[model samples]
Each structure stands twice: as structure tokens, then as C-alpha cells.
Target: MTVLATPHPTGHPGYSETLPREPESAAVARRLVRTALAAWGLEEHIDDAMVVITELVSNAVEYGRLASIRVVVTRPAKHRVRLGVVDRSRTVPMMRTDSNGDRIRGRGLVLVDSLTERWGTDLHQWGKQVWGELKCEPPR
Candidate 1:
């Protein structure tokens, strides 16, 4: 039962939640992301948000070494939406792909990078936050 908040400028809308570091957190994250984004009428972005949520949360659950997981959703004016996840691990962040013939278990951030307009990380107490942004607008 953790309440999360985000600072937004004008014309910004968002939602965030925190859950225990339990195995079911992933499922809960998926559901929460879908429900939150449904109001925006962006099912595609919602789906992507779900996937990104799973990956980010999974990483945190697996390696966060924290007590809970934090997730955020923001619609910053227009059709721009941002999804973020935070945990208690300060290992920075990295995205690896099988194409490099390296290990074979880290592709979460890779998918996020391909699907979101912008994605990055931020350091917090004991851990870091990973965020992905999606823009619903005409082609640039």
C-alpha cells in the first residue's frame, strides 16, 4: 500500500502505484497499466506499457533488492504518455540483445527501447528508476 506521486508541469496527467516485492507484482503491474491507460483510448500504447511494465518490474523484482516496486503513468498534454518503474537497486541500467551473442536472458529494456519514443533511468535511494515515454502525434 505505497502511494506514489510525480511532478508534472501544466497540462499533465499521470498515475502511480507501489506494490510489495512479491512474485505476483508482475501480474498486478500489467493490470494496473492497462486500467490506467484505458481512459486515454490508446490500447496500443497500453499494451506496450504492459509489456514494458512487466519487464521493468521483473527486473526490479529479480534484482532490485528492495521492499516494493513503484510504477507511474503520466499523460503530459496531447497524446504523450510516460510509464515509469522504480526499485531499490543502484546498478544503473543496461539493455542487452541476443544479437550480440552474449548472455541470453536480458531483453527487457531492449523491447522498451524499440517501442517507446524515449526511455531512460534515474538513480534513487538504494536503487534506480526506469522510464519509457510514448508520443501519440502525427509523424515528425
Candidate 2:
């Protein structure tokens, strides 16, 4: 159980969880994302967050060479949510493009790119962390 103490601008604590590297981890990640975001009253962003979480976890399980994956969902400021997926692989993710036709694979990051405000990666000693940020206005 890894704990990330992210200090939000409004002093709200974030959500964090670590799960084994398995095919089923993506579903667990999505559930966690939904639950956490709902707790934060960010229902409007749940769909996007679930999609991003699935992609990140799938990539990690397929390519990441680690026993566990860590997910962190945070709101650094108002109207913004940041989702991070950490795995034990240093290989950076590439968004592939097939000019000739639509490929079945490699579209995960494409969906993420189109949905999020911004997305990027960070390398650590053990592996890399892929993250995305979404800007959403919560319902009043």
C-alpha cells in the first residue's frame, strides 16, 4: 500500500491504491477511479476517468515489468483532476498512427489524448508513471 500525500489547493486529500499486475487490474482501477471521483463530487468526469484508467492499466499490465501497479487520482486545484498510473517499466508509451488504415490496437492513448486537457509521463527509479489531467466543471 503506497500512499501519496498530494496537497490540493483546496486542501482535499487525493485517492491512491496499488494492485497486482494482472489482466483484471484494469477493471479494479476503473472502479477505484469512479468511486474516488464520485466521492470528490466529480461525477461529470467519471466516464473520461474510467476510460483513461482502463488504458493506463492495460498498458501497464501488458508492457510493464513489475509485480504491482499504483494509481493516484488527485485534484491539484479546482475544476481539474489528475490521474496517474505507475508501473515498473521505463519504456515510454508511444501513440501510434496508422496512415493506411485504422489499427485495432494503439488507440488507447489516442482516446486519452482526445479526452484529457493534457497528458504526459514521468520516469522513476523503478519504472514510469503515465498521467493525464482533465479540466471539468462540477455541477452546482
Looking at candidate 1, the ten consecutive residues that score lowest on lDDT are: 4-13
Candidate 1 lDDT tens digits, 1-140: 54343444213336678888776988887877786666556676666778778877877788777688888777765667777788888887788755766656677789889888888988866678888887765233
TM-score, one value per model: 0.79, 0.87
Task: Please report, in order, the local distance difference test score of every candidate based on alpha carbons.
Answer: 0.74, 0.82
Question: Candidate 1, clashing residue pairs?
Answer: 89-127
TM-score of 1: 0.79
Q: How many backbone clashes does candidate 2 have?
A: 0
Largest TM-score belongs to which candidate?
A: 2
lDDT of 1 at 109: 86
- Give a tens-digit lDDT track for model 2, residues 63-109: 88868988888887788888889998999998766552655777788
